[model samples]
Target: MPQTLDAAAVRTWCSLALEALGREREEIDAINVYPVADGDTGTNLYLTVESAAQAVEAVFAAHETGSSVPAPADVVRAMAHGALIGARGNSGTILAQLLRGMAERLGDGDHLAGALHRAATLAREAVAHPVEGTILSVAGAAAQAADAFPQDAVRAAYEGARQALDATPGQLAVLERAGVVDAGGRGLLMVLGALVEAVTGEAPVAPVLAHVRHEIGDPGLEPCAAGGPAFEVIYLLEADDAAVARLRTRLDGLGDSLVVVGGDGLWNVHVHVDDAGAAVEAGVEAGRPYRIRITHFDTTAPPREREQVQRAVVVVVPGEGLAGLCAEAGATTVLARPGEPPASGELVDAIRRAHAREVVLLPNSAELRHTAAAAAEQARTEGVRVALIPTRAAVQGIAALAVHEPDRRFDEDVVAMTAAAGATRYAELAVAERQSWTSAGVCQAGDVLGLIDGDVAVIGADLADTAEAVLDRMLAAGGELVTLVLGEDVPDGDAVADRLERYVRDGYLAVDTLVYRGGRGSTPLLVGVE
Candidate 1:
């Protein structure tokens, strides 16, 4: 009687799921009792899943006009692929894989018992060492329950997931400390919960997906809410698909809440253009755009300078940890990406959105020095000063954050603060679970990778080797003060430090390292020479 589902149903379900996630998103982040305490876990999951939801909307909308209908199969498949590339940290990676496995099960849109079983089995396989009381456990049990009552109960699948989630804290000691369930697991369950509610005739709770990742912009002087669509401008463009996409992308950097999703062979048209001539010329570069169907949306009769008041913020992350940490850092705006720096337009928009007199960008990854340079150039062109400090690593970003001075003017503090960071060395340890090539040498699965000044200097079978290599480089660079931030996975900070002390026994430098207990990650996990 009941089958896979319809598109309208899916969109409704997706929205409901996002709403539930937004409600309980933080609960998962609070589980870190000690050791590896990074705040981005929950936020990572939220953004990862949110990106998937956004992708679905974009894909579906295009499909409506003959784009492609991505059913359970397409939805999960695209989401998994996108999420994996867009994955932030450990939790985000696992979640992306889980989505991938689920998509495999629902391949070709068979929302039947067999499909459910296949998805469950695939999900279990994705996790190398599956932990109980987590999203995996909850998802596994729900799949099993659905197999048993495929016909008798339609909502059984969602309820099973919820039941499994309820026992999450009991499965992990850390979660028990927080007096809450697993945040990632809860987010997963909540999303599915919405699916259940949708099928059962319960009203779906819609989440605010469109607004969360808005251009960090000055809210403008005021909303056209004093009247209407702000600017009612129109323009016509005659360009190829490539040029149109490029132009569309640039508009994002220039303004806010822009809706310009229409382009074709000859004179493709449609736009709520904020600046008519700029929009038309952007398209005209490739060829000539005519008829431009131009009409400007005017709140002010003569039109006031359409400026948005906002801020730009940059963070260094390797996993979901980046999002959580940035949020806690009092960041008003955030964009999630891993390994590399965000583009020039992304940086410029951030500056404009923040209504920045001078934008401060922290390109935490060392290899991103060039990218930061590009961003700086763009900032300068816009008459906005961009203060970029090479935080080098996420640990460095965290450590340097203590010195952030929002109260001071941009010019004075940019110079003063950067000098402070230049005087210190950034050292961090992460597992070489993935293979990589670097100046450090060929990396293996079990090696503990050591990074110094943003380059891979050591990769060894033990953390001590990597730690020593990173420290030795820092010491050689002649920095008297070194701060080593310890992660959750690391054990015996003092013992490790002592071992290093023995390595450089010929003390020409006072290698004093401070260990702060915290979690560090960027959305793009691969950093430096990888």
Candidate 2:
């Protein structure tokens, strides 16, 4: 085993931590009592580590195309940034600050003990009000132990954290009353154990407590305490350090459990408050805030009436317009850049973000089929039932969505959506980049080209004439509905859409045409006949 951290070791640490948390999420969540008593500490830590792992993987991926390996500093920085943006809950936000502190002190890895001390210090500063019998206490104890045993610091830190976690009940009344140790401290111990495993070849065994409290029923659906805050607000903000400093003050006054973590003009703000709108407005005054989430807690629901999260639709689209369209239709849209297609890892990340038991994946580009299928398999291994719909075009995916019924059985639903997508025929209108030979004939560089079902079918000089010819050929095969999606470069005016509609009216009496704006993309227009 390696004695010090490098990019590879850092990557290993992240993966180990995420897997550990995933295994213990429900157990940690069950015993949660401090900081509002919402039993999601384990889930929050898993998500935070998952984000950090993704960022580290991205750094390694960027270097894979070349021969260079990422520096230890680069890996640590990515881990810190990922945790900052993806942090959740009170414990999670503090954990982000701790990781950031380590990033600040990371060097040749000989100073592992020093880095641990710095991390503990930074975490303490990030909290609005530091309390004992929490993750902060565990972090401090671990750092002190590491400082004493610098030769074997990683293992020392894990043992120190586990011992501190055992003493948490004496430090806090809530935990003592609940017959459990601090939940956040327990999670910190789990993370430290992973770090120990990373340094040594053998994994550390988790400590078993004698006075454990096993919470009955689904803890997530339970109500909060009588006098607690009614809402949870989270958002990512873009602002300077001075602005964030002021924001921290404002939010601290507005609510409890306030955490603002990040630096260099980007930060993630999370808080619990009765005035959710006021909290968000304070962020706006400081800087621009987006991806805002506000959830209201209901205390009156019975256990039987508590609602569970439903299955979700996960889709990959090329342009912003299609993303918005899919989002509006209740699908989680992953935007694929013009040239850089999403990898299997990215697709898997999107599936995890969906946070659903069942998922329907729409890889709207033909090139993304294998990647999407691979992602689906990975998700299945993680206990998520995923269905991959091999949609070769955005319009085909749209057609499939139109017929989707999540309330139906999973297999039945997949079959219906697949059939709907398969029944649609798609084509695109583009301008030839250079003189090229086609099925119709050789075409000039500026000539309009109509590609039907992935082949050049009609070539002409005028956009209107070429579109009409393509529509005529498609209608000859007998289609009842025609979808016209216009791109950004298309000339302003309803000329193309109107002319096509008039042509259909003059010849095909029963065909109906619908038009949609496709925003900016490579193709000038996309046609779907169903």
Candidate 3:
């Protein structure tokens, strides 16, 4: 086991903690009974540590660029700052303070025991109403254990936190009734266990809570679950400690789960209150607050498993109308603007936010192929099963989504979606911005160009004529259904749809057609035949 902690060890600890949390997030969320039962404690902690790990990785990247390594103090500070800024929910906000306190003491020539002791005190101070049988209790116990066995700091801390976690049910009435330990305390114990593994290179034995029971689905026992304030408001505030003190008192009166963490001029504020506006306005009265997030508590519902979300779809589409359509069809959507496409990081974030074990990704633009593939690889690393369908147009994604069946086997579902997307022939009507060369021939600025499968196929002065020509060509290849996506620039509104429908009716009597408004900033019109 490592006798001394350093920057490298801290980085390792962050990674280990994130991995452990990722694996156990759902379990911890299930046992959440204190403060509020929104069933996101595990996700919150994982996200908070994920942010810290990312920040630590950034530091390493910067140091690598400089051909140097960051000092232990600098590494610890970055970890704390990342946690503070990215802290989510009540438990996560308190955890940020715990890490911040440890960073302060650890950087000031303190030993592991002393730093842990300081961490516990600061965590207790951060909470507006410090209660027993929580993470605060577990932290305090770990500190005591560390001081008592300074030579084996990591093991002592883990043992102490584990014992404290086991005893939490007796300390909190809600925990006893729910037949579970404090969820936040359990999460903290996992972090401590990760630290031990970082030092020893051997995973510690997980603590067993044999007394704890699971009555999650029983309605009779469900109503016994704890409840809290209506809305949870969190933000980052830039203010003096004095101003923060007054703000704390005002928030304490507003609601519970009030935690104000951070130091100096920057603070991470969290509170559960009925009046979200009042909580935010209180922050304004204290200082400038930004990155504010508010979540309403669905008090009637029971805590459920988020990490076990069976399947979800994440799609990249252009225009708000397509986004709405995808969302209505139960898919998470990322909007691609006219001149800007979503980066790989955006797609990865959307995949994570989708919160599913299995995800079907639709990159509905040719330029996004590589980016979407990269995102899929990154998400897979985080244990999300991702299938990237190279759909070159929004209409192809629509066709793929039409055939999507979450209940089917994953591989079969992927194959069906892939086949549907590949079989759909897509084209778009766009105005030429200037005299340009095209596959159809040279075109003037006033000309409307019909692009089929990423190549200009026809050009005409009239929108109706151009669209008709493209449709007939697409149908000549054989199609039973025609999808018309009308954009904001379609000058004649329903006239364009009326004309297109009439054209298909007169010539292709066996074919059916459908129309959708593609919203503003989209191409003049999009056509898909399948």
Q: Which of the numbered candidates is closest to the native, going by highest lDDT? A: 3
Q: Is candidate 1 or 3 superior in TM-score?
A: 3
Q: Give the Cα error of residue 14 in candidate 1, in Å.
A: 2.8
Name the lDDT value of residue 453 in candidate 3.
96
Q: What digit string (tens of lDDT, one per residue) describes model 2 on residues 150-258?
A: 8888888888888898999899887877788888888888888888888786799868875577554434322467767888898889999999999999999988888
**Per-candidate local distance difference test:** 0.54, 0.82, 0.86
**Model 1 scores what on Cα lDDT?**
0.54
Q: How should the candidates be ordered by TM-score, best one leading?
A: 2, 3, 1
- Please write out the lDDT profile of model 1 over residues 1-530, one tens digit for every residue: 45565555556665676666656555555442211233335655665565556556655766777755656556655555545444433455456555555555555666645555665565555443457866677777777878888873346666676677677767876556545556556666666667677566664343222112112222211223333333333333456777766765765554433333222344223344356566666667755554334433435453456565333345544444444656577543344333323433344445555665566677666766765676677667768767788767665565455466777666656665576555555655667777778787899887777765556777777777666666655666465545444444456755765665565555533545444434432211121110
Model 2 worst lDDT window (10 residues): 299-308
TM-scores for candidates 1 onward, in order: 0.41, 0.74, 0.64
Model 2: how far is 483 from its true place, Å? 5.7
Looking at model 3, residue 330 earns an lDDT score of 93
**Model 3, span 44-109: residue lDDT tens:** 887788767767877898888676788888888989988887788878888899899889987776
